[model samples]
Target: MLTLNQIKNNPEELIKKLSVRNKDFSQLIHDAIKTDNKRKEIQSSLDATLEQSNKIAKSIGQLFKEGKQAEAGKAKSEAAELKEKAKELTAKLNDAKAELQTILFEIPNIPHPSVPAGKTDADNAEIRAGGTIPKLSKKVPHWELADTYDLIDFELGNKITGAGFPVYKGKGAKLQRALIAFFLDEADKAGFTEIMPPLVINEASGFGTGQLPDKEGQMYQVTEDKLFLIPTAEVPVTNLYRDVILKEDDFPIKMTAYSSCFRREAGSYGKDVRGLNRLHQFDKVEIVQIQHPDKSYETLDEMVAYVESLVQKLELPYRIVRLCGGDLGFTSALTYDFEVYSAGQDKWLEVSSVSNFETFQANRLKLRFKKVGEKQTQPAHTLNGSALALPRIVAALLENNYTEEGIKIPEVLQKFTNFDLIN
Candidate 1:
């Protein structure tokens, strides 16, 4: 959520930057300013009414002491009327504030200046790529390999939980755990403190990370408890600092979490959602950071590079793309996507998205920081990235590393999996 000061101070510049997202928010901005003005007016009137009522009450005491009964009675009547008027004005102020908040909620974060202006993922600009795509003689998709090796039981999972929930067995489960451990270890090496957040979060937690109201439909809801199943560890991990005020010394706060994320993934179908490509429940290692707004972009670059290293270690062919405005997440000002080439699928599968939200989530979370000597506080920048999402990474690994003998595990993960190959 954008701050009122941002909207009030640079309406034109904000609108211009937001245009990169290809949506017009001019009217929404206008409505917010208008509603805020009305709210201020109501507040002023309420204050004046209370002040006048106080003066009348004070003078009424003097009047009664002076034996001016008629004048004191009239003053009491006037005070009562002012109190009623103040109540009406307070209600109007509350209504105006709600209206203003609604308008602000509808408006998305402004796109960063580097954000490309385009309509879809096709329009995204490729930044850099590493590793070579493997030319596998045997191109067995992960699902087939999972079946041939008896690693995953798709039908059993379907019978138990329905589609999009595959049961990993034997080495399949081991590989999943190995990847989670590997990613967490790498994140710890990168200076992120580990956290184990709740799998379900309350509405405030969802809103703190800009997941609620906009992406409510994509999240699994525990309606009875008014909680939501986290779509990513990013939600709970980032929300850890909600409504917190930090000192300047806390310039960069980095945290990591591995969680079983649950998403509705509503309306997904076709081959795209097959096997390990897409799932309702999946494991992921997430990295989150809270940093000073001034250095956030630099931090974003570091985060991107860190994610790139993870894929490189996995020995997967990967590319990084700068998301165009249309493809950008609602809360992200700038985002970089990491995709790995799956030999069997013969397509790049998105494995991670590193984004800098640039105080958008902070404003919503009321996450702020004060300088060493300054009294005023400012919103802190928030960022999070999938250090690695396991499903697609596993898909790409199995598909690209398949041999007649077995699927060769990356040497880096061999120590964790305790085996060099899954035959």
Candidate 2:
């Protein structure tokens, strides 16, 4: 949520920047300003009326004390009328403020100046790519390799729960666990405190993370309990600082968590749901940061580099792309997506996304920090990234590392998996 002052002071400039994200603001901005102006007018009127009423009441009391009964009665009548006017104006002020807030919530954050104006992922700029694509002796899709090795049971998972929820067996399950631990370990080494947040969150938590009002359909809602299954550890981990006011020393709070993410993947149909491409439930290790506004962009770059290192250590062929305006997430001002090469599919599969949300979420969450030696509270910048998501990474690994004998595990993960190969 943008501050009314920001909108009022530079409406045109802000709207122009937001246009890069294809947001139209002519009407919404104007309406919000009008509502805010009305609210101020009503408040001023109410304040003046209340002040006059208080003065009249004071005069009435003095008159009564001085034995001027008639004068006191007249003053009392005037005060009553002033009080009634104040009440009416107060109601109008409340309504106007509510209208203003509604409009403000509808407006999105302005895109960062560096964001490219484009319509789709195809228009995204490739900033950097790392590692090398492996040469394959035989093309084998991840799902086929999983079956040949009896590692993952998709059919049984479908009968037990539903599609998009495969059951990992033997080496498959071990590899998944290894990835989670490896990612978390890397994040910890990078100054992120490891956290284990709740998998279920309330409505307020969802809105705090900017998941409600727009992506509600993409979450699993527990209607009876009024809770929603977390779509990512980001929701709960980032919400940890919601409504908090911290000292300057707490400017950049880094945290990471490993959680089983749940999503409805609604409207996704056909073969796109095949194998590990899309899933209703999957594991991910997430990294979140609450930083001072000035240092947020730097933190974002560092996070991207960190995730890139992890991907490179796994020896997976991957590339980093800067998301174009239209392809950016709603809460993020800037984003970089990491896509790993899948040999069998002969395409890049998105395995993680690192984004800088700036103060967009902090405003909604009321997450603030007191400036050094100052009494004012300022919103902190919030950022989150998937250190890595397991499903697609698993898919990429299986397809890219498949051999005639078995699938060779990455050297970094050998210690964690207790084996050099999954045969």
Candidate 3:
């Protein structure tokens, strides 16, 4: 949520800045300001009524002590009237405050100044490209490769469960485990503490990460238990510090976790739903950070470089793109998406996204920190990124490294996979 000062002091400037999102929040901003103003006005009136009531009660006591029964009765009556008015003002204040919060919740984080103006992925600016697209005269899609090798059993998975839940068998299962291990080891080497977070989260946890009520439809909810299946490890990992306060020395805190992400893929369509392109259940290694606001952007860049390293180690042809305003996540101030090229599909599949939420999630989480000699605390900045989502990375690996021999495992992952090729 934006600070109230931002809305009241510069709604016009805020509107102009967020125009890149292609939606106007001018009326919402104005309504929030108006609601806040009414809340303040009612609050002031209540304060005055309470103060006067206190003074009148004191006067009644004085009169009673002096045996002035008549005067005491009159002051008591006035105090009763003031108390009634205070009650009405108190109720008005609550309504106004709640109304303002409703409006604030509907607004998304303002984009950073560097964010480009655009409407969709086509508008995203490519930052840089790396690796080389292989020269493949013929390459089959990952689904075909899986079937030919008896690796993943989509039909079996359907018999047991449903679509989007492919069952891995033999080498396919081993490769998935190997990829998870590889990603975890890389994160561990990058100075992040490994965490094993729960797959199910409560409503509070969902809301803390801006998942509830915004992207609610995209999550699998365990309705009877009021728990939501985590869409990403980011939810549980980042909530580790929810409602927590840290000392100045804890400036940079990092955590990494591997989780089986569950998404409804609510309305995924057409070519987008092919094979591993979109899945209800997929594995991902996530990295999260809680940093001092001043150093968050630096941490964001560091995270970007770390993800870049993972893609390079895998030897996949990839590119980094800066997300345009419209494509940015709800809580992120700035985001960069990393796409790996899949030769079989002849498309760029997004395998990771690194973002700096810059206190947006922290504000909702109530995660705060105290400065060295300061008595007051301020919200810490939060950031998270997919170190790499396994499915698409696996897609690119199988597609790009395919040959008559078999799929070639990346040299870095050979030790984990226990073989050079999967035939």
Candidate topping TM-score? 1
lDDT of 1 by residue, 164-219 (tens): 88999999999999999999999999999999999999999999988877789999
RMSD of 3: 2.2
Taking the tens digit of each residue's C-alpha lDDT, what string does model 2 give over 183-255? 9999999999999999999999999988987889999999999999999999999998999998988768999
Overall lDDT per candidate, in order of appearance: 0.93, 0.91, 0.91
Q: Residue by residue across 1-423, what tens digits does model 3's lDDT show?
A: 676876778889988877878788888888888899998899898899899999998888899999999999988888889888989989998999999888888888889898998889999999999999999978789999988888888898788888889999999999999999999999999999999999999999998999976788999989999999999999999999999999978979999999999999887888898888998999999999999989999999999999999999999999999999889877889999999999988889999999999988888899999999999999999999999899999889988999998999999998998988989
TM-score of each: 0.96, 0.93, 0.94
| Candidate maximizing lDDT | 1
Ranking by TM-score: 1, 3, 2
* Shift of residue 195 alpha carbon in model 3, Å: 1.0
RMSD (CA, Å), each prediction: 1.9, 2.3, 2.2
